[model samples]
Target chain A: MNTFLQLLNRVNSRVLFFGLLFVSLFLIVRNNEAQGKIFLNSAGRVTGFFGSGATAIGSYFNLRRENEKLQHEISVLRGQLAKDQYNTQVNIDTLQRVLDSTRIQIYKYIEATVVNNSVDKPKNYLTLNRGRHHGVKENMGVITADGVLGVVRYVSKYYCIVMSVLHTDSRVSAQIRGVDKGFYGSLVWRGKDPRFMQLIDIPKHNKISSKEDVVETTGFSTYYPPGVTIGKVFYHSIPPGSSNHLIQVKLNTNMANVRYAQIVVNVHADEINQLEARAKDEQ
Target chain B: MNSSSTLRISLKFIIIWILQIIVLKQVQFLPLGPYYYEAFVYPLFILLLPFGMHVNRLMLIAFFSGLLIDASYNTLGVHTASAVVLAFARPYILALVLPRGIDEAFTPSLGRLKFLPFLRYVIYAFLVYLPFYYTMVFFSHVFIVEIIVKSLLSFIVSVFFTLILAGILNGLD
Candidate 1:
């Protein structure tokens, strides 16, 4: 205790010098309004500078999570598009139509990240980080921004498996754009190239004049919306003695490296199915 | 430590303190834009304190003297903090400027050191004092340009007045 006191005694001048300085600084910050404001503002600026720097570095590590959040937001925005809504306005009269403008949202998109995907296999499938809880049902059409992916085959509580467009068994009803009422056919993969698909069963009687004819969804099935472009018609031929044309189509979406996809939820699917079932029962 | 010397020192302190508050405090030079600064000669008391005085005692005396000026100006700690810095630096500055073979009890005076050396000492002391004083006044480096301009301007006017005051005083010499 005595030695400690002696040690403190030797440094007492320094201690007092610093103590008085601290007191002066405290008084300046506490008493004078302008000086206090300057001090507080400068201190706040310093802390804020460091805080934003830390957030910048932390955000770099959080890119994947941030991407997922943005994807979800994009899905919500995609669902609100005018094309995604169904117009239920039956033309009773022009005046009545002006009074009644009813647009029902027929499709809601649920965004999902591709956890696993394969294009090299004969039967390719994609695993998505979405499930029944995310409103992804089996038979819901999966699509990217460019083209159709496949139908959702199976769904769990937290995940779903989608049959990719590159798969052998995958079939999509596709149409060719033309001036006349164009023809549509079942688009199928020929188990060879992942980038190309075969659109078959279009009757050769339909005039094929343009080389730039675009292959798109016919909207015949409940799987996809009308006019969703699947690909461009690359080549077509009437197989010997066959009445129908077999069209080779170049797919727009690159199936090998797809990272994100949206599951299309058709809201009136159950109603359409019931109506179709009644017609089948009558037959 | 004699009674007469003590009396003389006290009288000098009082005289300078009074002269600072009453006369120098009101002596406003024309404002040169935002670069205006006040003249301070109260620190001359700390500057001219006996060379043999302990640094700790010197600092305490300087602190109180500064506080007295602060009360009059309503700048409670700004002056005190600057004065304490001047008091703390006095010994080192004196060590640098004090001539060789000087007596141990030497107190700095105009008559003893004469004009040039005394001016040099005053310049060095104010060099330390004014910048620190302006720093305490402004309280932030955001006004760093203002601090430098004010310190330079105030240093010139202050040194001029302090030299004139020291020259007139007989007892201090």
Candidate 2:
């Protein structure tokens, strides 16, 4: 008894602190009103601020790793640039004025940093540093320098979240690289893997069959510029009695490692949207 | 142990409470940039209690003081929760900081513990209090990053004010 009292006496100052904490929590939970709600709202704002502060600290600690990543990224970009220049020049002679306009900037790329990103879930979203104030808006197609990613799902004044193409609802109009210009299909993800998406609705009779066929955005939609490399067709299957082939694609740009992305804002998006809206209205 | 020391603590409590409710309570960071938090030194009241004070008494005092602060700030129970926790952690902090634990008659003050030791102890206490306060306020695992960031930033600012106040009050001299 004396020993316990001795211990208690040693730590006596905090005797009631724990007891009160529970009772206080109980009061807080049970007796909340408008005042408590106001505090809650204020707390949300504070927590957001603090969360970013922690992120900044994490970034600071990860600066060395980030620097190494950038060095590797730059070297990769340099190699890709040489190849891209040659390819663009070779394709320019054979392509139409629409394709020519794409190279001449029908779409502008806004440089942005990935503030936050996720890819584990079925519906993965990424937050970009650009927002409504930075001319980013809802549905603006986002992509890395190498390939297509996803469209802007939501935007605030200074930040926006990208709904990655890995999501089930995300569908992009994509085409195989070849002689046939009109052979495009709706590309969709099967919600299984972040690294692969499936292109469905391609007519099985299209007869263009190849194992390593390259895929690119068709520019049939205003979301992505034409000829942005999406992935390579891994394999295709004619689903039993169905007339369409579902082609499995391996995405070129790894959605999980996307650090910096260029948000593709088609200058003609507004005009195209209006035209589409009017056509829908008439229908 | 003395009436004079108890009176001094009461006086310190009232002055700090008044300053907190009227002035420091309104001190919140600008809702801009990456970090947003409020630097609170009011929990220092619990930290300043005499070392040998019974835990039960200390916690009750902390609770009341926190409730009063909450009532004024329009955040009913937030300050209470934080204050009680700070009080609860005080003895443990003392035990951790002091190599010989705590003297039965020791009062946690700048005079007895010295400036640097006091600073270290107060900083540790603030770290514990601020993070808990923020966690309670946020109430979600999603804001985990925000809680940490806010706690760190708030720690720096709260420590600054706490040091200055500790220097001024000088505890039970």
Candidate 3:
């Protein structure tokens, strides 16, 4: 009985030490699982709670800059409108002189504020303040004052997530403004600086100008209106082993400081999408 | 049993968590190619836990810290699992590195050891961490080369950062 007590004591101490070690390791690991849900929930709550305050502060700081930009845009639009009104006769004459010159389309824009922006990841997403409640939906085109941002990927009641141009999965059918040969290329973030992006799959046969040619959407994709500005081709090179030319595009939109944006909701989007889907099915 | 010590530890954890979540999380220096790699600064928390702490307590602390970090980074349970592994391995590592006579009551601290012993401790700590960290991250069937490259780069960078942080904490103390 005395020997049994000693043995029990020895066993107890050893068990205790090992047990401590096991529990510590388990807790460290278990913490990860425990923390994930708790952290996310807490982050959401904290951000949601302080979101309004931060927005208010941001707006206050940006008021002057916003006013200045708004003024410049208003003046540019006014100047263009004046020119259109004065050149109505000229436009009519030109329409008669050229084929397909009279085709005019109107676009509606919904303004939204960017709440969160990420540019350094392979799959970058932007969160906006507007959502389904504001008539925003998946695949709607989003653009900043400078140019095209990306397309809306997901939507909630009060928020919408946009898969930015910086994402690997993001591709748009784009063409050189005046060139006849158009190509579908993926917009990829090179994980470098935020100001630059790479346009992949441009055929080597296509002659790319150094400085001035504009890259714009071809309207082949239902998400964007045809001729929406994307960026300008900055540089191109024939990679060592690949046949396609690697084109570097300087994005017009300054992603780092983008705040206010517009979501383009096409009225005929559903019909066009259905027709495209049927065509694909038939193929 | 002391309230002040508990408060100090909690404070330290919060500060480390905030720094990891808010500041270090944003800094991604990619020295490698298109296969994206970034340094994780959360291990400083693990390294900073009080030396010679009870094994279970240490593991619990590491677990909670890992959980907080994973949650912030949106990596579901990877950090927690790896951290727990590190916590469990820490004692064995200490035992292996420490001198025989010092095993009974020795705590891991810069002031408590010579240079070679410190280096050994750091090396062992790093070895314990690397495998678990890499395994959790690359669990999906990925290109072996990419996984190896990323893991190696991340391990090197994280170890260097951990050493610097540990040095700083020691200096401060």
Highest lDDT, which number? 1
For candidate 3, the lDDT comes to 0.69
Clashing pairs in 1: none
**Interface RMSD, one decimal, each candidate:** 3.1, 4.9, 8.5
Give the DockQ (C-alpha) for candidate 3: 0.03
Better of 2 and 3 by DockQ: 2
Query: What is the DockQ for all candidates, taken in turn?
Result: 0.22, 0.22, 0.03
Clashes of each: 0, 12, 3
Candidate 2 reaches a DockQ of 0.22
Q: What DockQ class does candidate 1 belong to?
A: incorrect
Task: Score chain B of candidate 2 by TM-score.
Answer: 0.90
Question: Candidate 1 lDDT, tens digit per residue, A13-74?
Answer: 77777777777777777877888999888876876788766557778899999999999999
Evaluated with DockQ, which candidate comes out highest?
Answer: 2
lDDT tens digits by residue: candidate 3, A1-283? 5574445445543354455445544443444565344545655667678776555677889999999999999877886785633221212232223335685333456777798999877778899877877778899988777677889999998789998877777776777677564665666676677787777888787777656678777787767778777789898788998878888888888887789988877767888889989999998
The local distance difference test score of each candidate is: 0.82, 0.80, 0.69
What is candidate 2's CA lDDT for residue A120? 82
Summing lDDT over every window of 10 consecutive residues in candidate 2 chain B, give the lowest-scoring window.
B98-107
